[model samples]
Target: MDPERFQKNAMYVETPEVFDAEKNFDDDGRIKRTGTLTTASAHIITAVIGSGVLSLAWAIAQLGWVAGPAVLLAFSFITYFTSTLLADCYRTPDPVHGKRNYTYSDAVESVLGGNKVKLCGLAQYINLVGVTIGYTITASISMVAVKKSDCFHKHGHQAKCSTSNNPYMILFACMQIVLCQIPNFSKLWWLSILAAVMSFAYSTIGLGLSIAKIAEGAPVRTTLTGVQVGVDVSASDKVWRTFQAIGNIAFAYAYSNVLIEIQDTLKSSPPENKVMKKSSLIGILTTTLFYVLCGCLGYAAFGNDAPGNFLTGFGFYEPFWLIDIANICIAVHLVGAYQVFCQPIFGFVEKWSKEKWSNSEFINAEHEVKLPLCGIYSVNFFRLVWRTAYVIVTAVLAMLFPFFNDFLGLIGSVSFWPLTVYFPIEMYIKQSNMKKFSFTWTWLKILIWVCLIVSLIAAAGSIQGLVQDLRKYKPFQAEQ
Candidate 1:
């Protein structure tokens, strides 16, 4: 599609009336703006950094020290560029255009065509749902870890609590139901800030603890070869593990799904592109530094034996308070991170509900929900019900498939290309109308091909590994 047509269709993608200055203003007539540079950074970081980073040691173990950092840095650059590309494509040529692309799916529809919207929507749902499930798993497992450490260190005995993580997952999913009640994306900035801080806190503690272990003469393994530190695996298994690591790394860097939404939160006069580029830089840089520390130090401390999760490898010798604090931070951050990514999904579903149930009692004249529970307050009935259901579904999935790192690897593989790489590059190429065989076009094509190959290999490897493991432990089997 041409750029002009893309601009016109944006009105159909996002509501035009809500952009009005008067409607967006407060009671005192002060203009209400959602975010600044800092909050944008926080939201982006919260979206980008989650339990995926915890698997970096396993990722590094897959690719080894040398290739691990190399691939990590490579994907980091690729994701950063794609993120900025999305930001650059976020607007229209004419100021008179009634709408801006406010979501990734909107951008996809704008640039590609209305026909591609469903395709984009599918990829988005898969990515968002997968990430949410990953978060639920991480949060529940983190809570369990915290409880275990508390029981062991404080009581001098292991906790006899149910080994299954399902209860904790349910509890935290209930907490998400309450948090998800905050209907506005504008209000989630504060939560994002807290989540960002929590993510950093846990990562920093993990790094420090790893360093302390190294200082205490803990055995350290150093190698550039692909090797399992603590576990024995066949060469074929190691090969699949290395491929899955690509997915893990890709997953760690997958935030393009929410990039446009984060950009929409910014209140800068210079347009969101400038702020988005800066925030993306800040968020990626901070997260990358933490990932390096956590991955390398965790590996240095535990060698080939580093657990899939950096914090999960901690033992009784480690400070109980620190472990408790770190795990708490992880759980809290995942809670907020879940919302950050899920907001766009919520928006999409709510819009669809409005179209499908135009005359339903659940909705009011202003498109708000008519529920008695939150009736006095403006709630989207579809949102309350659907978002809650989404959380529950993810929580159930987390309980069913508790393989944290493997699940993340599978998701990262499945969604990375379409969400992170393909849509961004294709949108840029189409929107810019870049000449084929030109320097930019040629390199973008090359990058797209590379992403396709990597995504296929990673997806295949992850699915194989998951299927093999699932055969050993059938669904719903309680943890021993």
Candidate 2:
């Protein structure tokens, strides 16, 4: 009667037609990897160039033109360098070969080999969860912007067209519930490609709109030292915002959390490490160029008063249709990027559940339902319940704290030091076993400590911003 209890263990019931054929498996005894340099590059670009790009102009405004671009480049280099180090740890006993570490946590466990395994998993997954929440807030903001753009077009630019982001956040969570059912990271290639294209579309729109605004030849105040004391902001406000700006820039370059997962999708030949390094270079270079142009042009357009998100922040009032299109692209991009980040969390939970309750049929059972055109699909009670619950929780949290820039800055500041910088550096040092306090080791130590200090200051700034936001705003009542 239920039709659910009938189907079970399709993985083991694989027909001869599907299973008997000679299949390719990598050294890890999984499906043959299909990812190439291009796909990896696409994945990196999709992850790195996200809603965070919308804030770069505001980040640039906090620092001056000279320091802004310089800080962006500095973070870019640091991220790329640490990424390369982390890439080599994908394999053990050797950089190019040895036991394969399928995830970032696996790499940390293999190299560092202590309670650090749990630490890595906790930090990585917590950061991933935080990122998905940030995306929820951001996508909803863009969706609200789209509706407001139409209202502003029909009415005047000064019209009170503001709306709360809660409804859009729910809508975004609904979409993620569907997309999150896609199983695993390998199945996300097409989504990554599409999201990469969307990232470019919106970024180009923002850049073009900024150029148009600059061409209008309106005088806007800008300074080499940006937002000086008393003129544009108080001295303490300037300090807090400058640190928060670094956090925003860090958030823009945050592609490392899922680096090993992405690498695992690659074909084993040519060494995943080597290919990943190339992908890193390509992705970082392209995004950096876009960042420099968009951030600088947007600042020049609006000067010290640049909005946190130029496209949605009403930096350009006419050409409302173009602004709507850009916001649409941002929402679409976040849709895919959200899944890209959350799939890892899903995997971790499923793996833990299976291991913890190995014999529980409820956790391991699968029912196959054949459908028209889409073919047979497996439905698991646990996955449906758990994944939906996770998405709902993130949506609720997003509604609670919808301060976009400050939230992004805090998440970035907290995770950047541990996940991006500290863990990678420590893992590389242990894996390579260069002498303690050697030139390389000493410099790497310095880098990690310096990054830790920077992240702490950035996190403090974001906390201050959040405290300020809370003073005047009510939860679930934010409108822009």
Per-residue lDDT over 1-480 for candidate 1, one digit per residue giving the tens place of the 0 to 100 score: 233332222211122333444545432233345588999999989998896676687678767889988888988899898988888767643212325677888888878877678887888888887778888887888888876776677566554543567889999999999888776687788899999999988888888887888899966665786575345467788888888878778888888888888877777465668888999999999988888877877777777766777675443235887888989999999999999988888878776766887676664232433445443234455556777888888888888778754666787788888888888888888877889999999999999999999999998888988888777766665543
Instruction: Give the clashing residue pairs of candidate 1, or none.
Output: 229-304, 229-305
Model 1 residue 151 lDDT score: 64
Model 1 residue 356 lDDT score: 86
Over 4 Å off in model 1, which ranges?
1-32, 93-98, 154-162, 228-232, 313-317, 365-376, 474-480
TM-score of 1: 0.88
Tens digit per residue, CA lDDT, model 2, 173-254: 9999988776657778999999999999999999898888899899998888777789889888899999889888887888
Model 1: lDDT of residue 94: 22
TM, every model: 0.88, 0.95
RMSD in order of candidates: 5.9, 3.5
Rate residue 425 of model 2 by lDDT: 93
Name the top TM-score candidate.
2
